[model samples]
Target: MGDRRLAIEAWESLFRAQHEVFGKLSGDFVGSDLSQAEYDVLLTVTRAPDMTARLRDVTANMLISQPSVSRLVDRMVGRGLVTKCSDPDDGRGALVTATEEGAHAFRVIGAAHGRSIAEHMACFDDEELRTLLTLTEKLRGYRSGE
Candidate 1:
């Protein structure tokens, strides 16, 4: 293969390896009582000023589709981890807000997740990490012809 193909292959290999590591860690974090996707949604809600976001906002940040988001939100609602509210901007759209319980749980879980990422990525120098981030962002955007 050409140099470009080799570079792409190398990147893909490393990405796959990292993904596997994350999968294992995620599984081990069952104590947190949050799936990786649920955690992402929680994070999004917690980071918002009102600890709430529109359904589409969370969907955009998640790895799932609209239907999947709806199902997941319903599950979360059932778990008392989140509440669905009517969106003020749109009568038909729903807003997702983390309940007080969800915020507390997310705090605990987010800390654990942060520690996990820190431990795993500790080997990379800050500059190396920044370069990798820049390269990946560039590649991601390039693939979309941005």
Candidate 2:
């Protein structure tokens, strides 16, 4: 029990330290204005092929709820960061696309995000990162009902 407690405490300390460093770095690089969710939507739209994605597709790809995604899209469209169109195949389904301004904004934000991720990873050796990813994926593959 004593050893278990000690190990848990150590793990927590390391986790907090990493979080603090990453939070500060990502927050700075992402700027003070854009919320993380907003930036996520923007970047996802920008990086999508043809700068377009079906509304439900974005929600599924982002692992967010449909209503939440819709609200986010509404906000973004209001800001002129995206354009909404009816999906040609399904009129009921809307397509969200990045506007020119949004694409340009993404370019700026994307560069910053790239640099931030690169800087954070600079401390890790390739093997360490690869091992971390492998373990994470292994643990994440549980069946949905499990």
Across residues 8-51, which tens digit of lDDT does each residue of candidate 1 receive?
99889979977888786786468667877888889888898789
TM-score of 2: 0.71
The CA-based lDDT of model 2 is what? 0.78
Model 1 residue 108 distance off true place after TM-score fit, in angstroms: 0.4
TM-score, one value per model: 0.85, 0.71
What is the clash tally of candidate 1? Answer: 0
Query: Compared with the true structure, what per-residue lDDT tens digits does model 2 show for residues 1-146?
Result: 56998978977986897798768666754444456666677777777899998887778766578899899899989988899889999979998999887777777777777788878878889999988677556556733443
lDDT of 1 at 124: 89
The local lDDT score (0 to 100) that residue 78 gets in candidate 2 is: 91
Global Cα RMSD, each model:
2.9, 4.6
Q: Which residue segments of model 1 deviate by more than 4 Å?
A: 1-4, 142-146
